[model samples]
Target: MSDDVTQDAVLIFAKRLGEIIATCEVSAVWIDSREPCAWQYIRRDGETIIVTCKTLQYWAVRDAAARNGYRLDVKPDEMDVMPGQQITRGIPHADKLSTLAVTPYLSGNSETIFRSAWGDGSEYPTLRRMLRYASTADDLGRAGVIGKTAQEMYGGPLNSSSKVQRARDTGAKEWRALSASLDTARDELIYRSTRPQKDD
Candidate 1:
């Protein structure tokens, strides 16, 4: 989707979310039948700021800073950017969160964006998805080469729990072998880089 469309969706989503929260009130007194629920609001930075009735936390600090439109640094798939960051007061305005930076793709260069969006997952799959909208075939190919090289260097299938378990049981010998393979792959990519290759 276009950036405009995605942004519009986010705006609509934010408004709807705000409306939903406006109707809900938390009271621990009714915990016997209805447990006190924690409400989380997704700020423009894609950070979910949660309000816990037990602590009577209203996200005053984060909300106050965000109300003035501060740039938020958030991790991917995280509820809060700075977890355990405390808020001592109540936020006066809620709509200000709509202006915070949310989309990861909107900031940084291609490489930086790619790396940030990938998180700790398999780099190849992430690269493949990012390459879908690449401006040129060469760009996609280069990313593929990078992905393949990274995958091989990582000993492949890091996400496969079973494989990792098997590798772990092989102990010190396997670690040495895998480490050697990775070093070789790193050297190969580095050697190619020093020769001055096309960016694409």
Candidate 2:
């Protein structure tokens, strides 16, 4: 096979291997770039199975069976991994993993922003700081900031526009204040939902 084809095949196999391992609650995962294999120790039936990413599906199946002390014939052609009912492939694979590992209680542009902010290596003091940044232009530059920060850092997607509006409509400014004041600005966003307004 050509080098490009080989690489593509390897990538596909690696992702499928990830789905399988994650389903088993492996607890830890690491890819071996040197060997071009993804290996993990997954828990199955109250036991551990060390599975390897090899093109020889039979070998991987046999090894997993041996490790788990199970007797099942995992056919080479039929050994495929599916995650959460989605047959993820290519970009979808990475996207699925992103949802698994990264997505928090956020949606839309805010979720985008939060992840981008973290990628830049700034460690905010608390969840409050993270959410306060969301409404700012600075935070808007990042992708999924609101979604991730609220979902992962805070309890849920408090920074989301829809939730913010709900709080506002109910005159529950305290909720937004409680969330936003936790961080850098230390003040509720004036334009935020549920806050009383005066004509400019």
Candidate 3:
């Protein structure tokens, strides 16, 4: 799909997702496409979830956090980006936290709810069902749903193999370098623009 189509899809998805998770305290939803072929959803709780249809394997949630100046505690290889799957990580609004207890819980719980409501299927139907489920579920039922999702995602082999880990490490290094270069270029542009100009 074209960029416009992809962005439109993401926006629509965000709207539906926001509605479904409204009770979960999702205050706002916005998309950032800093990485090509991938869209990152920035949440009000300082968590980020990234989605992409690209074939390349990326640590989507981590990269999104890194791009936004928040470093999550997860290893680079933990979560691989795949279509219809969201990688989520909680980040502090100001700086990295000394401990990761609450952030990970919030991030993991939110991710679980989303995956449960919208299992690997077409978007609209899944979301419609999810909304129905959320609308009727009490707090205890919602917690139960999240618990089931947590068990499923974390129960088995979420870990990458050695080879995959190596590749992820290399990709992370390259991504960091590129990000630093872009930051430098942006800083230079701002400096030049703000400097007092002399007569040519």
Off by over 4 Å in 2: 1-15, 21-38, 59-200
Task: Estimate, for each residue in 79-196, the C-alpha lDDT of model 2 and write its tens digit.
Answer: 2343322121221112223232221212223434444444432333343444565656454766555454444443555467664444333333443443343432212221232366
Model 1 per-residue lDDT tens digits across residues 1-200: 22443454455555544654685443222234564344545556776444443222233334334444432343323433346542223334443322222211122233444344444434334334333434344665444433333334356643355544443344344445445655565445445535776798
Residue 96: error of model 3 in Å?
A: 22
Q: What is the lDDT of candidate 1?
A: 0.41
| TM of each candidate vs. truth | 0.17, 0.17, 0.22
For residue 5, what is the lDDT in candidate 3? 37
Q: Pick the candidate with the highest TM-score.
A: 3
Error of 2 at 98 (Å): 31
Ranking by lDDT: 3, 1, 2
RMSD of each: 20.4, 20.4, 23.4
The sequence of per-residue lDDT tens digits that candidate 3 reaches over residues 88-126 is 444443322322223333343454444444345343332
Q: Which of the two candidates, 1 or 3, achieves a greater TM-score against the reference?
A: 3
Which portions of model 1 show Cα errors greater than 4 Å? 26-37, 40-167, 170-200
